[model samples]
Target: MMEAANCSLRVNRLLLDPKFESYKLSLDPLPCYGVELDTAVAEVKLRDDQYTLDHMRAYGMYNYLHCNPWSPDSVFYVDQLGRVMNINVTLDTALGKPIEVFRFPSDLSSCDRRLCSSIHFTSQDWVTLSDGTGTLYLIHILRNDQSAAGKWELKFNQELGDPFIVLHSVLYTRSEVQIIDALILSIEKDELDVEGSGFHVSLEWISITCSPNDDKYEILKRRNLHGKSVPHYAAIEPDGNSLTIISYKPFRFIADETNQPEEERMEEEEKKGKEVRELFKMTFALPEGAGRAVLSSGSVEVTLAKREVGNMWAEVIAGDTQGEFVADPAQSAAIAERLMHLTSEDLNPNPDCEKPPCNAQELEECDMSLEDSTTLCRFDGNTTKATHVVNLGGNQFLFSLEAAPELMPCFSLRHDVDALMWQPVSSQGDNLWDHAATFNALGYVQASKQDKKFFTCAPNFSYAALCECVRRIFIYRQPTPVSTVLYNRKEGRHVGQVAKQQVASLESSDPILGFQASNERLFVLTTKKLFVIRVNTAG
Candidate 1:
């Protein structure tokens, strides 16, 4: 157990000693969510020059603790030797011996275990790995399975898109367990083609018509818009065998809008070259889809999606208003069935949901004027669409940054400092997919003084761990009484709070590489040691 630290706050002139275990949330006097120092540490050292930081960093991206399906209680991780290590924190105090799961003469000579970087294409077992030489291999790994290939079996091998691509959401046929419908964006180059001073961008969508189980995937290159800039918010939609792009001229929130009058602002805006919010939607007949893995690839000016969403038409100018003409046949049967069902119900007036009158105060009246306000951010969306959303999901979500310190929303901006945010393309569609909305900052992570820290959250999200220097990790404990009302809150939502130099630090010898959080422990890997930090919230 860790001891409590004293925090001084000038609110209501009261002296309070918060155990630093939880936070008292209210904007005016938001409790400082402090840290718990090193109460316990045990050395579970590793073999020399075997499982280095590179292997740990690779495992950090594909942290399997959150996707433990084979063994509920045991945590699974891999080492440089291709050994699948399983650790049950409850049953064992330290990590046991390595369990060799690969087989020799497995027909995967080129994709050797030591040379390849293993990444899970799906949350479960299907892994499409790379040897970092632009070669991908399909492997089915199951530690507890009793199959022909046993734990590590190379199913099929093929040379696909860029090897250093991120992939997930494995697609399987509903009829049979066949892998199909995955999108691989193998970007040949990270930079746009520049002719002297011009930058050209291109996005190509190609769909595989057959199963990857046979392993004959194809690739096609799309055309590039040379010397032309893609419009803001432009996105591509994929149909059966083609692609569609939707874009618009945005009305960006001008930074110096405060200096212009409302009437003058409207008049000046009209003088611009193009009208604000100009809609542009078109189709590109490029194919889409992959076999199993949706590799982390291209997401720049172009976006690939299924259908058109978030398109708002002001008025319906033409037919289908009366609903007399049934144009499409596949929907006629479904439409008739729906009309028959609704025809039976009595005049179904909407239920009463009257909210109380606003008190005319700024807080209360602002609620009335919130015609376009939201509480949920993209990361907080339920199905997709939510406000600062009544304090994010039911379960605590952990967020990891490649090199931590550069990106935490940061603690505060006392008029002099600014905060930063890193938005990935995955959140663009999977989360809210708000094309028109500007990015919002609901919560924040207290940025460490050092900027190169590797960040990963605890399994339970009870706290967060960051490694900046060698052998030392700073701990940020999650504030308690998670509140949605940011009306003066000090800490960031979902981000654990820790002031500069006022948090717990775990020491080690070698450079700290990566971290994997489990229920009761956080597995900290160094150059040659695997240190376990026990997580406890109570003081």
Candidate 2:
């Protein structure tokens, strides 16, 4: 846990709207640091300072509400009438209120009140809404002056699925959404066993993706429940290939005792072998490598491939050098500079060479040419080593090969944790293709010589910003702590190093449903109230 001295936490403001209970909170999009509140019947916005209320409007009773994480200014929800509504905060109320973009059939019943309704904004203008009865509707919001001034138009509504009872749903990206469904089974054992009859839950995953055909969507994949535990949450890797599921709550059904007197059935169920199951959280990965991986060999050459049949393969091309690796761009530049300096020194071994080497101009020309050409630098396996795999947020990686003259860049792939291995491109096989064939097979139809200029030997600036934000929020919890400490998600560290008195006070007040964090601020929502806190951390 973080030490109290290292950071200070104080309540910035209480966002209390007595008219309705706030159940969800998210940050507004870029240029607006305000926070958005979802109260089922209305949407509210609080300014960055937390003292001022920016906007509030009642849409109606909604069974489900979801604010776009990337653009909180846009809110999507499912109304009581089974209609999907979109409220663009940027639009004026006089132009229109919440727009009814799509609606389900009148005969279809409202979603099961027991299960939470699903509404996810997959992108800025695309949304997926679920009525909880296995039906999903995709709505695309469009804006064009030809239609109307200041009026956004909704395109055709595309309906997909016959989903199971959706326990939870998440928009993996603009193109994919994953759904988890529960399958309950009843098992019978010997009559003498008191716990003979109980319920077993199996979970299933349904993935929905936009079809290649414009304006259409389809179920791309379905995974049946095969584990002993139930999955409660899931997140897709940035590459959109791997999935991680958090499982908990191993449960078994007991006799429905509503028919018997409550007082008589309570103790009877416990004594008759109905044991309570404790809740635990465990995470596991699923079907790997859905995205393509790219490896660059410092020159204008690069290889791109995908996993197939548990092996890494690339398209074959003629006269392609095999088993040859090249240095990354940065390393290649460094090598060229050193080689030029040595050649200059060797040609002019006199003290006067310090001022002007006899071959200085020749060396300079060689350096310039090397920048656009490939310098074959032999890699002695003993000296050249793949030292570290640097994770550039978004699943990109830089393979740091020490002692090698060049650097290598590797794109996104499912990391093998067991062996800490990366799939090497096929060196010698009939299927092995040259760089050109590999790129073409991966659908890089437009890839050309100029594309190599886009590859960087160093991490991007956005990655540095992410690291700085994470360093600012230092969240820490004590060993075996009971309460979860709230830290700025983007700024804090993983381990607990600090404790705030306000955290205990907040927990005592109500059960925390969830939280949203920006670089400097955090918004926490409980069952009854919402809190905006300013997180201050030591340098």
Candidate 3:
């Protein structure tokens, strides 16, 4: 282990035993799996204060290649005959144990070997298997079944008609036993009909939901997005209420046209093509809780953290790519008509107005005559260019806009009675704050702040801490403030700030990949290693 000065944390380097030094390690539960002496071997060894080997087993011929994310005791691999098998690591019998989970049908016997048999355990209870023929099955593990000890039951299957490929699948679970929802991202072939050869891609989003008391899984929603591009990564909020998708192309939304008459809609549809011309950053606002889910383009990663204000917050601190506008004059005119129709409908019933009410069509014609511009609203200044917008639950939102190349403008939005309200956050000025790191009950370390640190404590006291990511590890310190205020005129006296001492720095060699904090520990994952740091509070 390497040590640094003035850091409060300790570092420990873990090495595998000599016999299993060459094996690749799966850090899920600290297990290592690889070939040894021409035999497949799986072992778990962890050392903190002393060295200890937890479990070791060897398979004579059959290889237990991949580890399952759902459970630590299970591993799977495709057999020679294209059959996917799951092996239990705890089965210590001389014969060893393997169970046949799935096999392709005889009709699909000549399916492509490379893609025919791929299985993923998305959650503790849900597993997805594909037949390489555009069919996917969701398997739910019945743990309480008495007839068969570890039985796997098929819940449902979805067929994404010909020429559609499943790019990513994510399962959201509330606990070890309950799966709340699942999201599947797929790409379908467009005009270019040759099965695998196509430059035009139509992206689709499929959402599946299963209640806690029900055993059936149902498709809640499915939408063929307007924009065509490849998505890089996807994430679901902690509450399982929203999903954010990251793609390589600009995001577009399908306009809501439910209120239009069938004839008018059909006539307008004939004039407008299947795709929309105006391009915007991809973001989705689900009806429930009025949550805004932003799907940004590119490889930039977004970080989510809980706030003390009783809502969840997400911060994205990456560079943005300018989107293109490709609308022709005819397309612009058509869009303008639609926008005018929508605005007229919104003002048809005004309870505050005492004048005679006008019909939607009349109002639309009158409004169109007064203005040449079709756009209903527009933002002009640099502060109006939003980089990130977070849904703070209950129709409340926070937007981080770009003020300068390096400065950010912060504001909050909420509904005040019948009208909407936008208020700027005074605490966040033009200073360079870390948008990726968040504060919670545990603590947060930012390198940009002068004091360099902050932490939350019981009875309402908050302290500050700051650190720099020189290497992978953080060298942090708690600075002495020139003046500390403990009282608020309106809220009365507050809890006093805690004074932290100088300690040794936390050190690592690899680049930090991700960080997560719980009530007691901080888990940091680097490109090459994993570091589990203990959280200690000063009294």
Candidate 4:
């Protein structure tokens, strides 16, 4: 990791040492330097005499041991020049063979293409990748060597959002199965019949086809007892569909005698068996709907049992009509029926009332008044008038009303002015947006959570004292956590002014680039390089 001075980088690879930490070095005064650790597969950079450090532990950049070696693993193939290699890490790891079994160009047709720079070993099959961009790629690396080909190509498609697959560790099974633990997925070897039945679980999704009579694994099942007890099972199908169901325990149920009396244990075992076979049946349905429906790509419509769910039933429209219903325990069926009735009447109102004349006052004030606007309301009640005067926050104000008398009591700071500011849009026939070579401004912007407005701090001498302002953007590799101060020849120091602020924490030696204040968040080239300590407004 990076420190504040005397730039030094270190890497190491240690498997069984709990006290073992990654290489550490100082990065205080040096511009650039590299150091290697025997336990690590990479080197570190030093800046400003400081260096940042990260672990060589699992999930770190250098640790690529995910999935069985015989199984294809997509890794960030690294080249000599710190670029992402266009090659894929394969399942084939035969001695003396090319570690990269396949590449896009095969013959280096495009040597300019980047070499692997970073890798995230996700599961036996899937991995989420990035080339330092905000965009992440979720790819599945599988062994297609069913034909015993000498080598296989690592191929994948880009996944739009965040990572897809998540990992799972412990697994459950039915008592009937001889083995209590079935490690369905692993990153290591197959039939891992180790001393303990437990195996690391990494849940990943891949396209697979099942043979007609192939063995099928039972995941979730529940058993009903004579009175109240029931057993439930949660399973994942070969195709990735999840199933949860209740089933009755079989007669061969065995009770753990260690925890119960011998005579009672036999009786309890029989009771458990009977409980497994009762009333609860599996009612297959979607686990949950999109929590709240919205108009995204299409109108909000929920289809259940091959029928469309009417909007009125969900309070989307004012009136209700007869439509298919989806039973939900959260909402009342009676309320749903009532809403449907209301929707029909509201949308299909009676045709007799003079075709409802439009309100001239509303039409004149409406933003679309020039068009044929329709009347939305008709007031028939008699009107009353009143007046009130009050002083608020040392300011006296008077207001008149033609409504209820309680309007006076309702006058509180509910609509009080929270903030005030002024900016010159135009001054001296020059627009503030315009700037000359001699004018420079560096302003600090902060967000006010209470008011929800981004406030740009007023420019002080920091902007005024500069000789000339150049609208230029520069990218520098910052490998230090400590803040730096930009000095001027005349002014002693830009007190209270930060040239660069690490919202939360900063690392001294980790190579950081392309960081912008507007889009806050430090980007580390790789997890092996540096693990940034981020700034959180909440804390």
Candidate 5:
């Protein structure tokens, strides 16, 4: 159904009250009404509004959220100070105070905002968070209790090798956590530095057990970095589960890193000297439903266990269109047999296909996430002034045009609707990026990165979603959400007709830190409020 653009224009009135136009966000009338403008309009009735987070940082990201294990419609938010809270916006008012959990560390206050990350695993009762120093903390959220030492608000600490080692993309199971970490945070190489820099994935696993008789929790930390073979050419294994990098030069593995005195540790590091690239391997288990699989690393090794192994999957994470999974019928049996044999042994392969080469040379031919913005510029010329590098699909990269803050005020630099652009690049070895042409413009986003990660694109390319720079998120499915919406003076924004795209608006004066769209609902978190809006992005 369509409606009028101005609400003050009554049905009985014959003459137009030209004065009523200024009340509307747009001066012109809409070409279409209701649902067409849903994506753009900001005012929306939601289940919740105010929720407080004390130490949120301006440069911080609290938008990264996860599903609440007990509450399907709600989510958990971990703020910059490492405090976790369960927020349920599915109701007019969440009856419960909503338990908020804090970390044992006395001070996450000094941590750098960039290196902060947290995850509340699905179906798991634990929460893991990371700090700038590469340190990690795994908290049994359910067993929120105090330890013997009054300082740490933990029941017990497992001392996982180094509490300071940073981790990424950790995989979880019933009794264990496969924590994968990167040896190098960012890689930058140039022609002058021929042996170019790269990064390798390493893993460590933690086992936990709980007792019913006493409120006791047991945690086992295993850190073993071992690699039996290194193939100089094996970038990634065929099954797609394991990563094998072959390098001729080999280095000694670090055997022990226990409770050595600080001075002794310093002396050991002094003697061992400059950075040595040890062959390391990190393996990730096949997804949950396949079977029982575990990914282990000191040097890492990931093994997949499947009951029906012959059938292959099209992609790794669903909707990732990087490559097609074309399984060769001929090798299916061999792979299945090998996988079956691996199942019998406890994470041991014939020759552990784990570990990357010693030196992470600029595998100019390698798509290892080891590359940073600099490396991306080296590989793709079109990405020269690109502020961010996002690999949405296989070889396609999406970028937004953003210059210095001073340049933003210039009309030439500002985008009318503010949208992202996509460009496809040749894989591995191609530096012909300058010769590359534009693909197509992504749909408009309401928010200007003002620059932060408040934007994310749907995999299927149906639409792109982002929160505007201020307090509004406009969801548009039309040429634009701005002009297509109706403004009735009486009913406020939605005066004449009902616009229906997934719509949510923050009522708070505080700036939004982060938000995520999942399951037809929008979850937004700001410094002083949390809003869960029931939306319909059903294009």
Candidate 6:
């Protein structure tokens, strides 16, 4: 167990864009799109054009798309303050007003104020607008008082994503202001710092550090620091990767007044008057493949105190390439088991059989052997075949044939069926088809336990279907309804489901049109003039 005490903490923050491109934010493209705070009523669609400026009373903001004569497809809009801006281009806006032609800033052009690739208000006070040009602005909108107006300043180089702001809180104090971001927020501080300056995987060499001045306690009222109720400060690492700041007021403490000299009793008593700093030592093994599992080659060890005693607040920074660590239990165990299975030069039948200390050379050699071994089947595009090496009928009749392409052609699978109903394979329609490329990219196939081949497709000449795997295939069907079955090879069962219809264009009833599907919910592509279904699946 490593004790964390008197340690200097180095902090790092990681912000990632989780790709929330799908949810069509019902942000109205009309001039009066915002909610009227006094009335709580939102304006829907108002005509946005040059003629709109004529009725200045009706024009609250310009949120409509403008088509330039030269660039017919380019969308332009004037903001609430009547500053012209481009659509789909992230720009710095003041309360939905373009910064370029802001009412207050007459000297700066829209392009001069620095443009953001994406801009959205996290809150009235906390705004996260990014330019993706390596610059991020965290504008703190102060109160609307005469002194506080136009007092916004950038937090400076905080490469934050739009969604991650939900984890952050801006702390204002008499002395200092700080922003703490956490996936888990602690109302009451209870965390213990792990030992050492840097994270370690082994407990044999451990370093622990603790501080008496707790962050939670420091933020508490000045009166709270005067009594026995003052919070005990501790920092603990929950694992190799998380740092938890903990605060607690202990119920009781063991006093060791037996051996202290009478001369130093007063000094010792004064020290005892202060809050006790709780600390602990932690030990855990780094599970194999932990680092590799998440596409990260770094790991960290965090030690957390028992939760019953204190409230814990934690801040977690993800691993980078510099400090790559692996700790996934399953992956780690599999790796160790593989190592143990390999032949070793210093093999011992006693305690060594259970766990062996392997050298770099031995580990490398073992990895090479495993890498050389091939899977049951490898798809080869050049030959347009799924090369199978499985000895199903033993060595006597080893099945080594590529699936005959004509034996089964995939048309369309049922939305709620177990197998893909196939048809003749041909590139005969306006639709795109590639037998060699399609089959080669197929992910996996299920083997048949029964006499029936684990594949089937719908009979449709209008659509083309090519089997990627024995169970999975590409069914190119147009016109509206479509259905397909995705078989799980390991379970030897087919998943029946309808493909979602893609909204290619918008209807005349629905004026708004755009494409959104990064988050995997609803994918919609639209045009103001027409509605087209790009992807449709009928069950």
* lDDT string, candidate 6, 484-515, tens digits: 55555766866443222111112233323222
* Candidate 2 lDDT over residue span 24-99, tens digit each: 2123221212233333322222223222110110001111334444543344555455565555443222223456
Compose the digit string of candidate 1's lDDT tens values, residues 293-371.
4544322233333233334433233533431222347556767987895574546555574755843553522122211
lDDT of each: 0.33, 0.30, 0.35, 0.23, 0.34, 0.24
Candidate 3's TM-score reads 0.34
> Cα deviation in Å at residue 14, candidate 1?
27
Residue runs of model 4 more than 4 Å from their true location after superposition: 1-77, 81-94, 101-116, 120-124, 133-135, 146-539
Q: Looking at model 2, report the run of 10 residues with the lowest lDDT sum.
A: 461-470
Local distance difference test, candidate 6: 0.24
* 388 Cα displacement, candidate 2 (Å): 20
- Which residues of candidate 3, in runs, are more than 4 Å off? 1-67, 79-82, 88-98, 104-107, 111-117, 144-149, 163-181, 185-187, 192-197, 209-217, 226-229, 238-240, 251-539
lDDT of 5 at 483: 47
Q: lDDT: which is higher, 1 or 4?
A: 1
TM-score of each: 0.40, 0.31, 0.34, 0.18, 0.36, 0.19
Q: How are the candidates ranked when ordered by TM-score, highest leading?
A: 1, 5, 3, 2, 6, 4
Candidate 2, residue 145: how far the Cα is off, in Å: 8.5
Task: Name model 5 segments beyond 4 Å from true.
Answer: 1-66, 69-72, 79-82, 93-98, 110-117, 131-134, 141-452, 456-464, 476-504, 536-539
- 4 or 6: which has the higher lDDT? 6
In candidate 4, what are the lDDT values of residues 1-539, reduced to their tens digit?
A: 01111111111122112221111232323121111211222222222211112111112212222222222222223333333332122212221221443333222213332112234333334333433211223334545664222333233333223221222111222243311111111121214436522222221222222111332322232111110111111122211222111112111111233522233565667866865432211222332454225423323334333123223334333575434444555456677776884576465477666744755555422122111211111111111000111112211111111011111111101011111111211233322111111111111111112211111111111111100011111211212233556454465644222223222223343332211111111112222332211211111
What is the model-wide C-alpha lDDT for candidate 2? Answer: 0.30
lDDT of 3: 0.35
Q: What 10-residue stretch in candidate 3 is worst by lDDT?
A: 53-62
